[model samples]
Target chain A: MTAAAEFISVSKRFSRRAKVRTLAGLAGQWLRGPKRGPDGLLPHEFMALQDVSFAVQPGESLGIVGPNGSGKSTILKLLFRILRPDRGQVVTKGRVGGLIELGAGFHPYLSGRENVSINGAILGMSRADIRRQYEAIVEFSGLAEFMDMPVKDYSSGMYARLAFAIAAHANPDVLLVDEVLAVGDAGFQLKCYDWMARMRTSGRAVITVSHDMYAMAASTRCLFIKSGQVKAHGDARQVIEAYLTDLSRDRHDPVLETNFIKTADGVPRAEIKSVELLDGLGRPVTSIGHGANLMLRFHYHAAEQVHSPIFALTLFHDDPRYPLNLPRHYLFHVFSGPAFADQTLKGSGTVEVLVEDVRLPVGCYRAKTYLFERDGVSPIFVQDGVARLEVDRPDWSDGRPLLEHRQRWTITSHVST
Target chain B: MSPMSITAELREVAGARGLAWMLASREVRVRYKHTVLGIGWALALPVALMLVFTFLFTRVAKVDAGGLPYPVFVFLGLVPWQLHANILSGAARCLTDQRNLVTKVYFAREALPLSVVLSALVDFAVAMTVLAALMAWYGIAPGPGLALVPVVLAVQLALATGLALVLSAANLLYRDVQYVLQVGLQVWMFASSVVYPIPRTGNLKWLAWLNPMTPILDAWRTCITGAHFGLAPEFGLAALISVVVLVAGWRWFRRMERVFGELA
Candidate 1:
């Protein structure tokens, strides 16, 4: 079978215009002749994608994982024909649909029903096709009762739901979905996943761009891109592992250390020197698997010793569904041994928190550290985002890695004649 | 670099006709959503302008209406002028107003300005009914030249679409185009023969003939009044100019289409 989409050694460059004094300067250049590079770009230009190539076969899903400004979105746009490749050929076999931005064509004053047809057409569906699938789109959105209401009055969740429903029903042969899965509620995301699975079973190709590890792992193959080049490709697990290793290397660079300190109440008597996340073998790591041994080590110095000092570590996940500052887990330990019992023990030391069989889900978490007195009312030294930890379940193939708890239950049936 | 030929671009635009229609209806629907008079506003503007011009020119300035009722003659001129002005202004800003859609989604870029022109046409069609009633009130019976109204309107649409495409694309590159257009429309209205007839014998006769809108507006008046209503050489010249603008402006617009997203 023919490939659903293919990019043959594509390269794209974006040019920056040099400031000219007036239209005369432009006219002078035109009279003198064109001064452009071989790639049609002027002197001041930046390469966005360089010699990038990939292909997606029918019924297969390809996930592109990359850092910001790594030309990930550019690839998707080229595939959708939004942007032409500067050098190389981009060939797509069939109808192309994009979920790049939800509710992109929705008018605030138009009713949900009206918006469904309009958005569907924008996604490349014919009017007759939109009419035929209109009821199904409304039914899938679960907004049948609110179809007549203008979209501006609807909550954001409802608006995204309606938009996604129309796009999902358009039935393109090749689908390109950006980082839109992070929107809406968890149930809606699962619904989207189910729809994608159905599309795959029906032999359609999919290309997804996301930072979410779980979503990348669910795809059949993955590409790890950095600085407009493909560092690794093929085998979702291997590519993801390579990506994680690269991330850890970047984070652990000595020059890249984060200086998180909160000394608002004057220079505190205590200071947190450094923080590290360790794996099962006591090796420093930036990511950990679910139900694995993990350790968090904090190094600190105290100028003046205090009694019954409390050390706290808070883990926060920047969940798109909630406020940024909310912490997912909190742990507070009071040092009551000889280290803290002394009335005035001034020295430097290390504190370690060893967790066995970690159950945190697959997502990036930030650790915050604080030192307080015995009463735990006043904080001596507080630091936010002292360290970062990424949790994952590399073994799971389907469903999100949300938890690791196991349940024990038995069912019994009783019948009476 | 050129991505596709003009024929290919036209084919792509043809494929997006459904989207253009949907967008046009959306513009019409949203404009009248909360208004009490709904489509009555479309008629009110031309009628009000006609009344003001009739009082100012026919009475105050003592300008001749070519022996025709000044109200009917001015109404005929005002209807098409409003169509041209509304379409050009709306199309000039359509791309900027939908910047979000332009940057995020992929569709035929021509649809943006074309839909604005189409929506303005709906308003023009509605306003023409009032023109019909006014002509009947003056007892101006239909003539053989009435069939030629469509031809005149077609030429006007061609001219407007060409100018709209050029202005919209240029506006994206430099916003000064929009401000210039606002001030330019005021001057352009007086240059055309919308309010008073051009003097047959005067130093200003050459100026009137030089204005492309003059012949088009004169052709519309001739068609409505059925006096001196045969095909004029000036009308043919106007048609030729409209075609030239349409072709050249379309080529320039297509060449600049690739950079619109980045500039926007």
Candidate 2:
């Protein structure tokens, strides 16, 4: 029962801003010690992971799930030795193969034929091993005729296929992947999963990092991370359930909270001030009963007069009853944009979109809002999963609400000969 | 915890030596794949430089080549000098140029610069053929000193690899290293006496003694043309400096490799 890879209380951090790397900047930093703030770290440094520990046993697959920047990739990088931990140790038992950022190792100018040998070497495959697997790789990629062509000319699918083929043939005892499972078409993605499953069945460990909850849940075990801390770890099903529940617990009205310090891209024409989810009485609420009246308010600040702008909102649900291949998809997308209003706004103001009765699967859901200029296609500002909405089953019902819709319907029976 | 030994550090890098050659060959193949000249560019650089310096030094500067013909003497120095210069320039951008691979994949980070050196050695091999032709045309017979040529080249590789490791690691931190390298290479070339004979007995000899490349290029010239294979104190010093530079460079690079992914 030996583990293939283990992280012993590993922690790591990265600067929030690009490092000042010139001699002059380095000298200034040396003199000033980089201007530490209230925290021990310099003003710009943020912890990527904090004393997280885990192990992947041989034949066991571990999936890491998290929101963006939750340190899932850091764990993978630590195992692969791409990024060393600042404190604690990362130990791997054997040759580690990576599908991290798939096709990132391929030379664009080299032909697919040339890239196979090179990428195989990069994955720690011996020349003899690469030669032995060369035929299998080319066959699996199904690009035999196009092997001599430069990889740059291949479509993305071809590029990924060839890259995966070589990496699969690397034949390492441990596998590391970062969202590469989401690449290619659905059929090909299934192929990648099948490959990893085959590896695991043969007693090799597999560690994958992804935002895809379905993929995470399918693994033998899952780890949920939030803001550099491991929040939950155990059975894949329970860990994913904990993450979804954490997503639903937005108690402080994080939706309308404006301290999200993302650098504005250039000077935006208009800035999103806040987005609020309100009950019919004009009071903000994170959760609402099923079929209750709901209104979405988009607040904005305009530096100057702007022509009619489009405000769009979409509600997404990862409802399990649908059993979609992907765990999440948009349930509804509504646009109050383009010709919705021909008028211009000069300053700060708010716009509202009202849904009379919200009927959705009885679970937590996410909402994404976007603001675009007159043409209405280009986004000025976007906020995703910042707002959560819940549709509870009506108290009158003793059973579950309908999965598709909550509506009255009458059907006449028909007999077919 | 104890710091890692240099042997262990280098062994970790050796684990990926095959990758180094693979990347190097990929570079060579890609560079010459569609070119009509192919590897002619490698031959072109030193021969073209020898011709330019033959005119400039023999006619305008009126410098003596210590009784040897200007083309043979200068080409001897140019062959190894080009190897040195190519590796230096390659090392300056090695980490940054392969930024994607550096960040996304895990291997010994030194492989990037070492591969750059390997590609430059391709150029060195092509340029050596022209030197062989120059020696034959001059009717210079190979002497007993000719056997020391590999030893000279070995020392030269040590020096080039050491500097490459330093430059590649430094360039990853400060982009200014690349810009500095352009001007630095010109000054370094003139200071190393690639165009003139190595300074043996003058105040300039002190400056020549200080430059690590001077002894390397001097050894190349003497070893090829059957000159005295004297193991002078200066030569010993240069070889010692090369070993120290190589050991230090490997140590420094291994220490800095932890941040390569983040910086890249």
Candidate 3:
């Protein structure tokens, strides 16, 4: 089968940050600036998409993942023909439905029904087709009761939901969605993902850009982009792993270790200088087990004198956007802050939160720690992103040392051989 | 795409009840929105202009009115000129006004200009009714030739719509077109037969005849007031120019459409 969308030697150039551009900013920039590229009779040009070529096959859900300002959205815009690429061609073989920023097409004064019809027509659905799907769209959007109300009155979620319903139901050959699922509540988001899965299974191609990693992993082949170039593209798992690994490298840490802490602004004043997981003899270890004795030591300093200070710690596994594991519910332990101890020397110390058996799922956990004053009168200092811990299943099967579990296989069959 | 498809799309635009209402209601609502005595301006401006033109043409210039009242003479021509001007100017910039609609979705961008033209039809209808009432009160009945008024009005509408298509597309590419059209329309207005009857006495009468609008407005006045308009030659030329302008505007728009989404 032919690919649904193909970008051939597509190069879009845009100027580097003159300033952050808003709609009003765009009006001024394009109006005053000398035009260049395309028709070279103009002057002063910038590249947005540069010499990039890629093709998306039928039934393939392609996720364009990148950090902010990486030109992921610009690719979507080009596909939608909102902005033309100066050099190369974007050949699309089918009816293209783009929800490039949901609610982008809705008029505020029009009622839901009116907007639905117009938006459907805009998506290339004929009037008869829109009429046929009108009820289905209203039902899918759950806006049947509010169909007559002006869209401006709808909340942002309602607006996005309605917009998605129209675009999805249009049954286009190629669909382009840009961060649309980010607007709705969790339930609606799940519903959208479910619909997208159906769209994939039915052989309609989908191109989506989202910061939602789970959704990206669930339904699509992923493309990782960095500064307008394709960094990685392949299986979802491999691509996501590579992307996360690459991103981890971007974090500037002098210690060459993944360390982190979470804090609530200034209230609980603590800065974790270092975090190291230690074994039974307090030796630093990179790997540990489910029932291993773990020491989470937080090194910190006091900016000002404090009467009494408390430490709050939490643990998270795998995902950076959400914290899913916590060994303690901020089990605050009080200690004398370094300020009051010695007059000549500033005070600093380490607080170790020891876990007898860390009951964490098999994954990496970044240690999150916070420190605060007890009286709640004043905030001294704060810091986040302390360090990292790696955990696994414990093995004491033959009464050998648990550390032997790192070996791939048992030695029982070797004696008979 | 076939012409049939384009026709169908235009029908879809016209048939859309909400769009129709929006086109009609917004024209009136927007015109009077913040102004005092909003809707009254619709009636007041044209009549006021007629009085000024009558004073200038009849009293100051001592021009003959061809045996009819000078106010009736100018009003007959002014109605068509005003309709054409409103439709042309409004339609030319219609696409620009709905900038949000154009970029957000892919419908026929032509709908914007068409909507503006349709909306102006409401104002035209209102003025036509007022014209009819004034003619009756003045004891002036539309001649047997009055049946041709719709055809004349249709020609003028065609001319305006064509100009609109061309200008709307042009405005997208060059921001300067709007300023150009504003000044051009003002000059074009006086050059047309809006202020005085087409001057048959002057050697320069052919200049007025060359203006497609003059024949159109003259045809309208001729149909309504039983004025001696040299119809056969003038109407023939008027029809030819209207077709050429309409087709040329459409062809230019179609050729330039690919750039509109980018530039607009």
Q: State how far residue A356 of model 1 sits from its true place (Å).
A: 4.4
Expressed as tens digits, the lDDT of each residue in B1-264 for candidate 3 is 112366764564455544434444545555665678766667776888888988898778976666777788788777777778887778667767766666655555666676677777777777777788778888998899888877887788778878888988877766667777789989988887777666755786886668888788778778888877556687778888988898888767766665555565
What local distance difference test score does each model get?
0.78, 0.79, 0.68
Better of 1 and 3 by TM-score: 1
How many backbone clashes are present in model 3?
Answer: 23
Candidate 1 local lDDT, A128-150, one digit each (tens) = 99989999999999999999999
True C-alpha contacts between chains kept, each model in order: 0.38, 0.62, 0.18
- TM-score of each candidate's B chain against the true B chain: 0.95, 0.95, 0.88
Quote the positional error of residue A397 for candidate 3 in Å.
26
Question: Would you estimate the TM-scores of all the predictions?
Answer: 0.86, 0.79, 0.74
**Residue B49, candidate 2: C-alpha displacement in angstroms:** 1.6
Q: Give the residue spans of candidate 1 off by over 4 A.
A: A15-44, A253-305, A315-357, A362-369, A381-417, B1-5, B200-202, B229-231
Clashing pairs in 1: none
Clashes in each model (backbone N, CA, C under 3 Å)?
0, 0, 23
Worst 10 residues of 2 chain A by lDDT: A408-417
Give candidate 2 regions above 4 Å deviation.
Answer: A35-39, A251-417, B1-7, B228-231
What docking grade does candidate 3 earn? Answer: acceptable
